[model samples]
Target: MADSVQRAFDLAAEDYDRTRRRLVPGFDDFYRAAIDLIQFPHDSQLKVLDLGAGTGLLAAFIAYSFPQARITMVDISSEMLERARARFELAGERFRFEVSDYGVDPIQEKYDAVVSALSIHHLGDDQKRSLFARIHGALNDGGVFVNAEQCRGATPERHRFHHERWITRVRELGVDDRDLAAALDRMKFDRAATLEDQLQWLREAGFRDIDCAYKNLIFAVYRGIK
Candidate 1:
């Protein structure tokens, strides 16, 4: 299952970054809002881990924001990480790349922040809950967890509305029918949970100051401090 998902990401790796903006509604602000939550002195050498760090889109922003950060980018696809490697080639030891399925991997390293974007939504509800707990345990005191994710709506009707809104908006952004079909194909693997359930899971994982920092349609950014 993981291997097939990895293959899917690998297949999409080349065009992933270019099409991302058109595919997602409110792209810039959604990502900027997530970046805002990791409060730190710009020079701090923070230890950061990005789970399922596909093509390093989110990690690139983080690296730019926190220049001295020791970032570990973990994903199930080497193809994706290869792009990440090319993206961060000059960073040298400042960035580390690993191929691992974080949903089931042991994150034993203590990090100042653990972040993921558009990745955890692929996990089952049980997997998400357990992963939340692991993330909390892997954090240092005062560490934070930030997730920029796709979520389900609070109800079935709302889910339908959200779906419609996304479809309409993406089209407006000039994602053609073929591209939209491909995007929908990828979404088949998404196991998005409600924003409410995810917030509760963070709470259960012993996170404080948990909040849905930003939301639009079914896309949301969540932050929690350990």
Candidate 2:
């Protein structure tokens, strides 16, 4: 499963960043909500980890918002991380990369904040719960976990609504048919849990101040404080 995901992303690496904004209809506020919820001041020199960082788009947002942040980006696709490396080339030692399956690998270090975008939903429900616990353990006392993710709806009808609404919105945004088809194909690996379920899992993982900061169709930004 991991190998298949890696291969799919490797093939898309070149076009990932370009289509990202269009593919995600909620691009503007979805990412902004995640960044704005980070409970830190601008000048704090903090350690941040980005799971499934992809081409480091989310990390780029953080770096711009928080200049003193040092980031570690973990992703299963080397091709994607290669793009991320180029994106952060002049940052010197401020950025680090690890190509590993975050699901099976240990976070291994404490961080001030941990963030992920359009990832994590690839994991099964059990895996999501376990990873939430691991994420909780990997954070400092005041650290926060911000997940800008795709989530399932609370019911079957709602789920269909979410899917249809997304397709409609993206087409309205003028994404070409080929690009839209590819995006839908890659989403086959997604195993999204409902927002309520994920919030409960975060609570079980011993996180506090849990909140769904933003929601737009299937897109959401949820946060938890340790």
Candidate 3:
């Protein structure tokens, strides 16, 4: 299942960054809030890790925000990472890339901050919990993990409403049929957890400060500090 999903993303790599703005409502604010919640000195030398960093969209934002940071990005899709590589080519050794499935793969080092965007929902609940534990272990003291993600509604009625509303909004944004179909196909692998359950997992992982920094309908930015 992960392999198929990786292929789907590889196929969409060329247009993934452009389509995200349309598919995700409030795209700017959703990401901006996540960046804002990161409590780090702008000029400090920080080590950051990005998981499932498709096209490096989120990592690009992080690089711009923290010029002194060294970033390592891991993703299952080499094609997607290729785009990220080209995007940050000028950074030289400052930016690094790895090809791996983050859920089952080992995270090699500790980081001052670990972040992921529009990823992790593909994992089952158990994988998500296990990954949270790994993330906690991988962080340096005072490090933080932030996930900007899609989430499932807690109840059937709310789930239906949110899904329908997202469909309507994306259609209103004038998404072409090709892109829409591709996005829907990829969503088939998404195993998004409810907001409450996700927060509980973070707590069990030994994070100190946990909070949903921002949420809009089914999209949210959650953070946990070690």
Candidate 4:
């Protein structure tokens, strides 16, 4: 399953960023809210970890926002990482890449902040919970974790509305059929949990000051502090 997901992403690596903004409703706010949750100073030389950091989009935003932060980006697809590497080629050692399945890989180093965008939903419920615990352990004191991700609606009615809104908005944004079909295929691997369940899992994992920073239908940005 992991390999399948990796292949899907690797195939889409070249054009993923171009299609993302239109495909995702409230894309700007979702990413902005995630960046806003990172409490470090702009000049702070913080160690940052980006989980499932495809094409390093979110990491690039963080780097632009916090220029001195050193980032380690991990992803399951080397092809995706290659794009990220090229994007940050001038950074030298400021940006590092690792190819591994974050679901089971050991995150050996501690970080002052961990950020993920449009990822994590690929894991099953149990894996999500265990990953949350592992994330907490990987954080330093007062470290923050922010995830900008898709979530299942709380009820059947809400789920229907969510899907409808997504379809309407993406179509309105002029998303081409080819990109839309590919995106839907990738979603087959998603195992998104309800926003409520994820917050509970974060609490169980020992995260304090947990908050849903932003939510728009199925898209949400969550924040937690260790």
Best-fitting candidate, scored by lDDT:
2
* lDDT by residue for model 1 (123-146), tens: 999999999999999999999999
Per-residue accuracy of model 4 over 1-226 as CA lDDT, tens digit each = 8988999999999999999999988888989999999988889898999999999999999999999999999999999999999999999999999999999987899999998988899999999999999999999999999999999999988987997899889999999999889888988888899999999999999999999889997899998999
lDDT of candidate 2 at residue 18, scale 0 to 100: 93
lDDT over C-alpha atoms for residue 65 of model 2? 94
Clash totals, every prediction: 0, 0, 0, 0
Lowest-sum lDDT 10-residue window in model 2: 20-29
Give the per-residue lDDT of model 3 (tens digit) for 1-226. Answer: 8998899889999999889999999899999988887899899799999999989999999999999999999999999999999999988999999999999998889899999999999999999999999999999999999999999999979877998899889899989888888889889889999999999999999998898988888899999999
What is the descending lDDT order?
Answer: 2, 4, 3, 1
Candidate 3 weakest lDDT stretch, 10 residues = 208-217
Off by over 4 Å in 1: none
**Against the hidden true structure, what lDDT does model 1 obtain?**
0.92
Report lDDT (Cα) of residue 196, candidate 3: 92
Give per-model TM-scores. Answer: 0.98, 0.99, 0.98, 0.98
